[model samples]
Target chain A: MIQLRNALDVFTLVMLIVTIVLLIYTMSVMLMQRGKGKTPTNPKVVTKVRCVQNDYSAERDFSKGDYVGLEIGKCPKCGDTLKVEAIYAVGGPKEKDQPL
Target chain B: MDAGSSSDTWYLILLLMFAISFILNFTDIPQRIQLWRFASYIRRRLIQMDEIESDVRRRLINYLGKLNINSPKDVVDNFMNNYFLIEPVDIEPIDIIKRLSHLINVRDTNVKTYAERYMPGIQKSERYNAIVALEIASAINLVNKVLKHYFKLGLKNNNWVLLMQLALEMPNIIRIVNSYSKALDAFFSGTPIGDGAGPLLVRYLVGNSEPKRIAEDTVYYETLINGRRVYAIKAEGPGANVGKPGEAVEKLVDMLGGNVSRIVTVDAALKLEIEDTGEVAEGVGAAIGDIGPEKIGIERAATKYGIPLDAVVIKMSLEEAINTMTKEVYDGVLKAFERVKNTINSVGEGGSIIVIGVGNTVGVL
Candidate 1:
């Protein structure tokens, strides 16, 4: 009877060890998955402005020191402030300081 | 049975239960994967067709709701852009009539029901006339849609009947010609006349009639207010006489002792659907026929002449300009000119400005 009782005690001890190990492994996995769900915060602030027409030429003959007015609009991509300037004519003279 | 043998039996039972549960869990994986793939395919196709269909539907509903009959031309123009992808094919008159009839029948049925609910007396009054006109417009739009559909199918099957049929329909043919001519006019005539600074001159050296050509050229030269030279060479004439503007520019440059530093070419640009009219966009492209050929020729000539090339493009829609040039459109053009002026300032060489108005100068001074 004592031998039989000792065998039962040994089996119970083995099952307890196995369950504890599994529980620890499951908890670790759940914690790792939870950590991955967080979104990274962005720090940069972006703004957009629409491009409007402005008369920069005093003589209106298209001389130097003239600038195109941009009515700034919000940038569709990255939500940054987009600045649009009218570039040179196609097949026309290139500006010394080209505003891209 | 011995104790050890009984313990071994219990262990085997536990292992069997685990195996059964594992097999059952894995059984659902293939079905889940299939369901996911099917859903993804449907989503992609829906997104692809949604934009085009929605645009078409919006225009159709708006026209139907208006019940106006001023001109079906605008409706056709909008329909071609929103629905038809490219040029219309040749189609038979009978087929076109049949298609139009089918569309009218459907619309009449729907409108009749709608009229009963909303304006029952409209069927007998002037309001009915407006409704009928709208129905006709819808029918015309539907016919265009059908033509587009069949053209695509015909291309795949190499069917000549479809092409010939499309060509036979007189009204459709007229619409196509009118649309092309209007587009050409808008492309050539950047800004509408009488709006800002009035209409500018578009000169063509060659065309269908010499008298017409002379009249056009004379009018262009006579209409100069500020004395800034603006002209365009069209492809409407024979090959020998087609490149007049280029030759004129060349002659002018040579007259100045060939010391030309840079060349500026100005023309009207077609606006995309998303682009607001008068929005200025710059990119390297052809110099004349399109961005490709024009760019190639300009680059080659500039290389030979050792001069720099720049271009200013004015944006407008052929359809919008044809229908009317509102104050807003005129303002847009003035704004574009200002932008052009700024662009020119940045170029230091003080090059000669060649404002080539691209389009048919019909009724334009």
Candidate 2:
């Protein structure tokens, strides 16, 4: 009778420990999963442009080889037809020249 | 033994209750989160759609109503005060024409009474003067249209030689009429064309050619600035016509033998902010609409041709963009162009870029 009672007590103690361990593991796993989804990736940035002058002339003459040139025209901000030049072309193999 | 046993049973019940409560709370949290997310998402989309629908509705209604109104002061006042919820940075020329037409036709006693009461305070104002001049121009156009029809009919009946002579001189007559219309349009809109300030530069460059030769005009008159061909096309409209910018682009693309790569369309973007100084924004909305059928036709053609479409928006309040264009009016547009130019160059794609400045340049120099 004494041995049976001691075995029963041991069984209850083991079961309680298992339950505690399971609860802790569950909580930790939930927290880890939550942390993974919190951050976001980078978004695409869009650029804008305006034409300030009707007849904008480049301050410096653009050679055929120049990659980009800015035409000094009008100031969009101050309404001043100032020297505002932009990159007009990419001097590379022309689209027609490229063998498709 | 009895008391201790009872206490243990009570403790067991308490733990069981807590366990049940924990389970319920955890289950409820996810459902609550989902509900909140759905609610917020629906709310946001609803608001955006509402805004777009309202704007479209307002523009359509205003355009339809403009031709019928008779008082310039009333039309201007209503437009300035109420037409748009947000003040535009700049007004489009078409919008100015529509408003001017309405102002000239408005015979409302209430509006006239209001104008009379307020005119003394702002009689010398440039805005006021512009409205007055617009009214005068509207009257002139009405008279001219009637006179032209009558004169043409009378000449047709008078003699065959007269009819032939008139037919030969039709272009000149049209030019004179256009000039008169333009001057009136300029005076009211406050963007005089012949004096050389706004759209006239583009129009003179683009509109000089015969209609058949218009397609080839883009290559010579069009400038390749920042990897883009800035082509200007003029077409008749308060509504979009098939012969406008979109058609011109399609014809140009076909001529290039599918070698055309990317297109960047630029146009006036209406701002909703009342106090926003007309500035240009770069991106998609600029080329979306306002060219009528031409815009839709262009989009279809672009899609059919498998061409990539990009846009640059010049920001202006509708009122400012339409009624008046100052030196800084195209400021936002210029900025957008620079950004797009840089982007295209960076990409290093040797594709043809089309930068279209969309608007009615009726009186703009």
Residue-wise C-alpha lDDT for candidate 2, range A1-100, written one tens digit per residue = 4444555578679989999999999999999979754643321111112334443333332232121112234555556545222221112111122233
- Candidate 2 lDDT over B1-365, as tens digits, reads 65566566557868998988887686666545544454444345334434433443343234324433344334443533222122222346546533542342243233335445544343222323334343433443344444456445644454434444444554454434433433333333233221111122233333333323343112223545445444444332111111246556667667666555666665566655443443545554227454243565457656777867777555554334433333344354345546665645654444455444455433221
lDDT by residue for model 1 (B141-230), tens: 455456566655645565545544543453344444333333322112222221111122122211111211321121112111133222
- What TM-score, to 2 decimals, does candidate 2 have? 0.35
**Cα lDDT listed for each candidate:** 0.39, 0.42
Q: How much RMSD separates candidate 1 from the native structure?
A: 18.7
True contacts kept of each: 0.00, 0.00
- All candidates: DockQ: 0.03, 0.02
**Per-candidate TM-score, first chain only?**
0.42, 0.40
Clash totals, every prediction = 45, 56
User: Which digits, one per residue and each the tens of the lDDT, describe model 1 over residues A1-100?
Assistant: 4544566678689989999999999999999979754643311111112322222211112222112222244455544443322211112111124234
